[model samples]
Target: MTNEIYMTSKAWPFDQARAILRRLDIEKKRGIDRGDKPVVFETGYGPSGLPHIGTFGEVVRTTMVRNAFIALTEGKIATRLICVSDDMDGMRKVPGTVPNPDELEAYMQKPLTDVPDPFGTHDSFGNHMNARLRAFLDSFGFDYEFMSATELYRSGAYDEYLLRALNKFDDIMKVMLPTLGAERQATYSPFLPISPSTGRVLYVPMKAVNPEDGTITFDDEDGTEVTMSVTGGNVKFQWKPDFGMRWAALGVDFEMFGKDHQDNAPLYSRICKILGGNPPVQFVYELFLDEKGEKISKTKGNGISVEDWLKYAPPESLSLFNFAKPRAAKKLYFDVIPKTVDEYYQHLDGWSRQDEKQRANNPVWHIHNGTPPDENPPLTFALLLNLVSAANASDTETLWGFIKKYAPDATPENSPGLDRLTHYAVAYYEDFVKPNKAYRDPTDQERAALEDLVKRFRNVSAAESNDGEALQTMIFSVGKDHEFENLRDWFKAIYEVCLGQSQGPRFGSFVAIYGPEETADLIETSLAGNLS
Candidate 1:
């Protein structure tokens, strides 16, 4: 029930937070003075394309761990989350999802911060995407400081680290060269100098390195040899070197990345140490897959974005999706929305009944940073979607008409959460469920059972019809009397005949909410082969 119990929680966030504490202990034992500086948490972003769902996931997951660390320390330790955008990285290729692909082709190999903004919004493509990233994170009310790699490099923030990297260039190369193929290793250099001739980031090998002068010499695009300072934005490290340099320069205490970076993690840590700074505690989460089980890519735009998820579901549901089984690859698509929405509310509904230890492990507690909302929806999302299908509702008002009748006390004003769900249900039903509906004629046995149910409904009293449990009992008896082998098949028949779906909400509750007489009429319509 206390913070002490939560500190020992088996939740993944707490596990990661504990790793940070262990790292701090090790550092203190080594006589490393961290002083009163806060433990820094960093999440990186590549601003070559629009921010995607994967970007959102990293921030959300990191925030969860940060909150866990705060709870474990009981506010004794200060913390900061830095969201740094790698805008200075070269535009290797034009993203398929962005506008004006042809225009971007001219800017290939240029730093993303130097490319023109295709949307005509910000000064550069990188700035536009950075703005979008900040806006997206701001909408979630995340507490973070946004840093641009270009700004950091140009403003002398990275000068010291850049010069240190120059001094240890050969050692850094020794860490990286083994990872590259023969052809790549032949041309590889830790530093990528920005060419003065073409203003492009050249991938050419360094001709000479002067640690004293803190500069590098490389040939320009026109085959003219040039020497430039590695400091003050004149040069940027290749990605692997940049990753470790960022940890050292920023004094990052904790950070997380995708599984794709797992193999390179050791190299990063080594480079960080080589640059005279300790590597941060790192957490490697699994990558997200698209609907087809292909890895999601920012350039290819193969997966959904945060805005896409928000269109059919609330933000809390998306947060729940990001929170669940983070180390396992999840299929991010529209089909998962309804299930995640229901699961989010299910967790919320159970949060109050859970003990402190149980609550600490609940996803909603982490989603809300331990202060989850007290609101509970009257119906599950699955039930609402089923209601939409049965009622053929196209709008929120129509859905609410039946909802108000079922629960007289609930209104759009008092049940804001439920009201929002109604809107999402209607939208999701219209976009996904309706077009794919397949209504089939019942078999002879199913028809007989349906007729028997309609006959029983005719004799039902108003009080029994209003009570979901009572109606459920009656429905169960009908299924048993009709010799249905599996009760699930009987429910399936009801869903297919009346709702035009293979699965749906509880039939008894549907009957109670929609009225017994109305359900009987629906079955009769289905029997007449007209419901679909």
Candidate 2:
């Protein structure tokens, strides 16, 4: 209810915010004067390829924590989310998913910002991907300041940090060398100088490090000796070193990354402290998996995109997916869409009924920044999909016709949320549910139960037919009377014969919405093999 109460909330975002507050308290006690600075939450992006769902998840989750922190502080401390794109990093390999892959091969070792744009739209490959990243985040209306690694380096924004890194080169090397293979250890350096002649990032071992002059001497690809300043875009830190350098340079207060970065987290923190800066609070979440349970990869493009999710469901559904179980790995696929959509509405419907403490733990509060919209769709997504299958509805108008008949008071104007769901339902049913629907003839006992159900429906009064709970009880009684070994088998038979699918919504709810006599007619048709 109150900000003070919410400060002790058990919600994951609130928990993360509390960790940050504790970190600040510790720093203040240590005479670090961090109270005046706005807490900075950073999410890194490598602009070598198009942004993926992982990128969206990180930014959104960080935003949730940032909002929670603001609420906990009650506007006393400011917060900022900086989305930094590492466009200056070298492109190791061309992504297979992008257009014109062959054209990008020549620029393999060059910084992504310097490589040619395969799409032919932006000045360079990294610029094209970064624009897409910005557009993606902007579409969600996220509050973040975009920073380019190329711009930050070239404009001397990282000059001070680069000089610091130069001075701590040996210390940084001590932290990195053990993790590398024998051959990689021989060539690895904290600084990767951009070659003047070839304009490529060289991964050569430093011949000499001159901390006093803030420069490094290394052999070029041609075996020619060269010297370059670490500052002013002359050099960029390798990814591992860059992670800590960014924390030190920006004074990042919080960051959340996937579990893939868990092993190197200590390295990042060590390097941050080595460079005379405190490491930020870290939140490590499990990685998202594709439908086949493989880790989702931007380069491989094995998982659904944000646009793909929005195509079948609303943005709120996607947010709910990200909000739930950040610490557990989840299968991000099309099959999970309808379930997530229904879950989102379920949360929305229950938000008003929840007590203050319960509301604090609810995902919808974090999803909508503690102000969830008042939307209570009367039907679940599963029900809508079944309605589409049974009525063979191809458009929202057709689906809305049934919705109006089922709930006389509900209209497209009064129930805009349901109206939107109808559109998504039609598209989802057509794309996913329709093509896969399978109809099976009922067994002898199942046919007898169906015939008995038809008879019972004909005898039901019109008023009773509209009562979903009453109808559900009647269906359960029918299943019991038929002596079906498992009630699930009876429901499965109904789904296969009547709905032409292996799974369906509550049959009683379906009868109440579709009309009892109409459902009887459907059963009779299935008995006569018309549905099959």
Candidate 3:
């Protein structure tokens, strides 16, 4: 932490963005005063399974910090954002998310880069995963340079670092042993040698290390001593030292990982310092869980895939999901889609209304990489969903009619953004909302109140009706008149009994988008116990 972080009294955006910038500024200044080392930001990817939302979240969140750093630095400093893939890691087990689990059993404990691609597309399983990870990040237009651990180690990119670790094996063991069980502590080795016998990397205990000759002599499973040079692709590291070694070797300035790694990240920081290297500034975000708070993972295959989310909502909502207070674990489920979409619009709404200083605090500003997109599609996803139900719209043109009615400035030529959102809204409604929609029998009090509202709507022509805000006010007035004190229950009844959910968008905007006449028809249909 630096004093630049606490200078929010000066009206800077006081959040993760500012803190990231402040930390980078402190590091950059110290580095410059010393020798002007390049500031490097890194996010690691585990290519053990197919990429998911959590995979996207880390890079996206890091990019947010990178963007914030660049904004505060005004492009003054050189920065490198690196995405490293641990493809060299062994395929310990076949991930449930992947195809043909049984086939991978033969390759268990072999380096991932050597395991055959079950999909038969890429040369190896690790290569397939690496390609998929790249495609995933590229889909979101993430600005990052990709590095392969397989290439790095096999080609001697990490040879110098590998030798350093070999020479300091005892020191690495000192840093790593306390956390291990007594059995593990007795056998722990900082380096795993590629076994000459089984032709797979072995975690067997080292009998001796020749730093002078760059060879590690380790005992095989049969207690046969085998000596292999640490150079070439013969050696890779266990994770704790691997992390520290990479940071020291690559000059990583900052990085972030999950809270589950909370205990482990610091151990790497310590090992890095022991290796005569400074640790990267670290941030630990909470882990991702399903809607039920169950842990999300590749083996479980329990959480939403990146494809399903982008199919249902705009990609910007994903950014908004990442931009929230990262320390808090959020539910990354389909249920969160509507709220995130609406919140993105809310930030856009604030950006238009707030002055330049305050707009910097807006999440959309950071999400868009400091240039907020033009305020278009001025409707929320929840409201659009309600409109889909209100008009019973099956396609875009019908929805466009309502959009054009609400915003006369919208035209087919200019409203491509709205067109895309309309398509997403219709698909989301049909897939997630419509099938679950059931007609709830209206209560007697509710029936009478809705009956009165219908009568009022019957008298008011579509052209002469009050706008969304007025229509919203009048509906709430019916609830208040009937003494339904809980506005939440009132809205729940309106949405569930009418729209077939416990909630929808703001009623005023929903009514405005669907028009008062259509809303009346919807109310009348629900009141009459018809879900047509």
Residue-wise C-alpha lDDT for candidate 3, range 1-532, written one tens digit per residue: 3233323423222344455565556756776352555568899988987777788888988887777666666666667889999988877878775678788888888889989888999999999999999998898899899999889899998898888877887888888998899999888888888777666778877889888889998787677878889878898889888899889888887888999889898889988877767788788898878988988876677888888999898899888888787888877888889888888977887787777666666788778876888765777787788888877888988988988778888876787777788889999988888887876877887788778877776676565463776777777887888888787787788877788777776787777777677778889878777784
The candidate that wins on TM-score is: 2
> How far does residue 464 in candidate 2 sit from its true spot (Å)?
0.8
**Which pairs of residues have clashing backbones in candidate 3?**
none
Of 1 and 3, the candidate ahead on TM-score is 1
- Residue-wise C-alpha lDDT for candidate 1, range 1-532, written one tens digit per residue: 1268777788899989989988999999999998999999999998876677888899999999999999988889999999999999989988787886898898998999999998999999999999999998998999999999999999999999999988998899999988999999999998999999888998999999999998899899999999989989998988998999999999999999999999999999999999998999999988889899999876577888888889889999998998898889999889999999999999999998999989989999899999999989888888889889878999888888888778989999999999999989998899999998888999998999999999988889977977889998898898899899999999999889877889876788888878888889989998898976
C-alpha lDDT of all candidate models, in order: 0.90, 0.90, 0.80
Q: For candidate 2, give the lDDT.
A: 0.90
Worst 10 residues of 3 by lDDT: 5-14
**Mind giving the per-residue lDDT tens digits that candidate 2 earns over 280-365?**
99999999998988998765778899889999999999989999999999999899999999999988889999988788888998
Enumerate clash totals for all models, in the order shown: 0, 0, 0
Error of 3 at 109 (Å): 1.2
* All candidates: TM-score: 0.97, 0.97, 0.92
